[model samples]
Target: MESHIAFGYSFQAVGKGSCSTWGTGHFSTFDNYLYDFSGTCNYIFATVCDEITPDFNIQFRRGQNKKITRIIIELGPSVITVENVGIIGMRRMRTSSALKGPVKIVPPKADVGH
Candidate 1:
């Protein structure tokens, strides 16, 4: 549950089981921290920002037996301010099928305009 904010965005440590139940509000910030619990949970999603700055570093740690699905970083009605962009994990898959793969970092354009 350790979390912090970087460049006006919040980044927190999310457990494996916690990703499935996360809401859009959880991704309102420009950064996020994900921890893979021994590969128990294999999927993670997030809401992205409208503008992606260079300072946005989306960090992730995969446990022994876990894999990530869709890292949905949604763009909101505001500009995304950051200094770096990154994704740390296994392979990525286009679809979700309970299988293990890399971390899919999605940069979805914000539905609403800022």
Candidate 2:
């Protein structure tokens, strides 16, 4: 089942076998909770809600692995807040240099009174 929240949406799977996938736009959020007993496959993908303006977040987790990956992509001059990523199996999670700030956006002009 999928649920929509104020800042974003959430998905929960609780059963012996179940799998699902979802996708959303920018300025949107996603929270997923899964409880699998008989082995299931789930996938999700989210993109910028607005074109030429990137502001989105992707959060996912797997019960067996207890792994969660949160990726935040912000565009058009803004600040992003990413936190609360717990330790993973004695190994600390770190961000690589490749992950940087927002990039410039150039929106196309629209024809008016044509």
Q: RMSD for all candidates, in order, please.
A: 13.5, 13.6
Candidate 2 is scored at a TM of 0.24
Q: CA lDDT of each candidate?
A: 0.31, 0.32
Number of colliding residue pairs in model 2 = 3
**How well does candidate 1 match the true structure in TM-score terms?**
0.20
| Candidate of highest TM-score | 2
Candidate 2, residue 72: Cα displacement in angstroms equals 1.7
Q: Top lDDT: which candidate number?
A: 2
Compared with the true structure, what per-residue lDDT tens digits does model 1 show for residues 1-114?
533333222333244111222212223322234432334333323322343552223433233433232232323332322112323234322432332322233343334754
TM-scores, each model vs. reference: 0.20, 0.24
Whole-structure CA lDDT of model 2: 0.32
Q: Which stretches of candidate 2 lie over 4 Å from their true place?
A: 1-44, 49-64, 73-76, 79-81, 85-114
lDDT of 1 at 54: 27
**Cα lDDT tens digits for candidate 2, 1-114:** 333333332322233222233223322223434433222223233434554544432333333433223433232344343333432323456554322233222222334763
